[model samples]
Target chain A: MITITGLSKSFQTPYGKVDALKNINLEIKQGDIFGVIGFSGAGKSTLIRCLNRLEEPDSGIIRIGEHEITSLNKSQLREVRKRIGMIFQHFNLFDSKTVFGNVAFPLEVAGLSKRQIKNRVEQLLELVELTDKTNAYPAQLSGGQKQRVGIARALANNPEVLLSDEATSALDPKTTYAILELLRNINRKLNLTIVLITHEMDVLRRICNNVAVIEDGEITEMGPVQELFLNPRTDTTRLFVQSDQDLQLNNYSI
Target chain B: MADDLLPLLIVALSETVYMVLLSTIMALALGLPLGITLVVTSKGHISEFSGLNNVLGTVVNIFRSFPFIILIVVLLPLSRFLVGTTLGSTAAVVPLAIGSAPFLARIIENSLKEVDKGKIEAALAMGAKSITTIWKVLIPEALPSLVRGITLAVITITGFTATAGAIGAGGLGSLAIRFGYMRYRDDVLFATVIVLVIMVQLVQWGGNFIAHRLESKHHIGM
Candidate 1:
């Protein structure tokens, strides 16, 4: 479980002070696939990045289970980060490394023996169904394969929380669903808590048990996907839901 | 004539190789850490020590601004102090290394800057420390470009060694200017130019090969 209270962050831009995130409060229960949906610049990225202290919050109390993440010093924060895996929209896999090597990186960082790293990486590859691509460089993999590598690498440390920063945004609709299904499967199998930020409503409707609608650094609506989709209170949520349907409708013959 | 020129050519070529190699080693030893520190300390970087970054930048700029020929002359006193006498290829190494270090630092800095920011972030997010990120991520990622930069530095230093030889530093450059040009031996001048060109070609070819190998390994996948 992760809880954030009074979280706020602002950046000093050339124009003026831009508040990237307002006084945000939220809770993500363990094993729940929680989605934070918003348009570009809606603070979805900032909010999730803040959860990992990748983008530090100006003032907040972020408790990931028992650890007060925001208050932890440099080394402690690193220790906490090992338990919280984060993936990016770009699938930020190390270019220099093979699929197996990328998966083994976190294990190496944790000071695991070579034997242990090999075993763990093998298991992760098997889990992600990329065991055959163990020797292949990231360049050799397709978009879907790359994301699977990203997912395998993320789970290397046995992290309790997985933060997805628009992980499927770069993929095609088919690839996007495949990745989302993978995420859903991982969440169920490992019972790992996932906090994913996306502008796509299909992402939310497909896997997210609960949803939060963010607009200009504030959460305008929050609830289960069924409730939010059945009745969206805010125009932002309505727009996102409508756009996702329009996209899907376009793909269909009817 | 060929027999007489052969031994002199051999000696001068050895001296040129010796001067360039020693000074390049020195330059790399000094410049690599300085360059890494410069990048890591700059604004929005991993270390983020802007004051140190600016100060180092100014220092590197101050050294890099001086032309190699002028720098060799100006650094004579320091070279004399360090290497005991400033007359030969050995003494020439000091000024050459000093002149090249700053330039190499800038080259290395640029190469490091080209490393994907996402790789560094990924390393950091994986609980790797800043120093680890530099060694394990930044350096390896920038390696091919850095190798190319070293090749450029070596070629530059080879050219500079010729200038050093003009100051009585025994090498092909001195042989060219003295027994070749001054003595009106056009054959010696032609031979030395050919050797220098060949040396440059070899360095460039080797550097490109290594850089290409590294590039193929990653193929800019990130």
Candidate 2:
């Protein structure tokens, strides 16, 4: 459902030019939960941002469904963006808007009538189990509930692809598990193509079927999650798998 | 003499209100868009146009740095051209609005800047156009602060109105100078000062009330 070829991005810092993503290529199948795992500064964030053209790549080709996202003009890209929903680590909700207002934002942008927007927003809220909090503002909700609003808002347009940018990073482990479960349920229910990036091995293990290890702007390992977990190839992948095991051991000891 | 004082004070107070209120409306009309433009066109913003941003910034700065008294003199012809005379409270509004507009713009820019960048990115990611984001996200999020800033602008313009009275614009300031200083009627000056204080207090109180109400609704989430 999504394909990228020779993607590259660099930032000109005061010190010098630093490569954020260097010649990255990947493919994600429809209805698959694809995960990119990397440490901070490993460029995973940049990689996912490029998928939606939120962060413009210095050079690359990004294809989502039939649209070549990188080649689209401003207006064309905006039209295509309606089909690609993105959620952030911070939830990025509008503080001024209530849950219903937040979820209805995309519908409003899509130019739906007031009745259609209310109906669609209600449906989306039910999907994310936030129906009870419709009129509540984001600050009034807990972290998990806010994330639920984010999920509902992301799904408002019935997007074909859902991009999660460390969406659960800010939550506690218990909350993270529940949010991931929600994402899994969403993926299954909608058959949506999911692309997520994270620094946590547990996050990938919990939901991602296919995982890629990124290091210093390059993908060092890519394969099925189980295969990579059982027989890791690179030092970074091995460290990640080892850490996941260590976490399990600590849980057992506790 | 004492019987005539009440009517004269009433007229002067009304003129002060007229000049302040009209100029404020004009300032808002001119300044809001200028402020939005300053924010939207800056480097790395939604529609990043650094050249236009710098030029506009410089113009706003230049206008802002001019003293109000100098601004009145400098804008004399504009006031005359705009209102057909440069001596009355109506003519004074031309310089007053022009003087306050850039100051209000800076305040508005600061308030808008206080909105979270992440919220803007979220708006863009959802396929919202720049105009939609500005109207829906930036302006709404900064509304409370904008109110507070406008309160300050209105108070500043009120002070300018008094100064405008010095030159012949009929208001409390001219009333004080003409009667209290020239005619040696300290009672007239005292009355004018009291009225001006009451007006400013009402403006501040009203601004705070509205801003607090908005903040309760919008900022509780932050």
Give TM per candidate. Answer: 0.97, 0.98
Q: Which sections of candidate 1 miss by over 4 Å?
A: B220-222
Reference-based lDDT, residue A40, model 1: 96
Per-residue CA lDDT of model 2 for B1-222, tens digit only, reads 488799999999999999999999999999999999999998777888999999999999999999999999999999889899999899999999999999999999999988888899999999999999999989988999999999999999999999999998889998999998899998998998999999999999999999999888865744
RMSD, every candidate, angstroms? 1.5, 1.3
Q: What is the Cα-based lDDT of residue B8 in candidate 2? A: 91
Cα lDDT, all candidates: 0.90, 0.93
In candidate 2, what are the lDDT values of residues A61-94, reduced to their tens digit? 9999999999999999889888899999999999
lDDT of 1 by residue, A1-254 (tens): 89999999999999999998898999999999999999899999999989878787999899998999999999999898888888889988887788888888888888999999999999999998988899999988999999999899889999999999999999998999999999999999999999999988888889999998998999899999999888989998888878877888888956
Worst 10 residues of 1 chain A by lDDT: A245-254
> lDDT by residue for model 1 over B75-118, one digit each (tens)?
99998999899899899999989999999999999999998787
Give residue B90's lDDT in candidate 1 (0 to 100).
92
- The model with the greatest lDDT is 2
* Count of residue pairs whose backbone atoms collide, per candidate: 0, 0
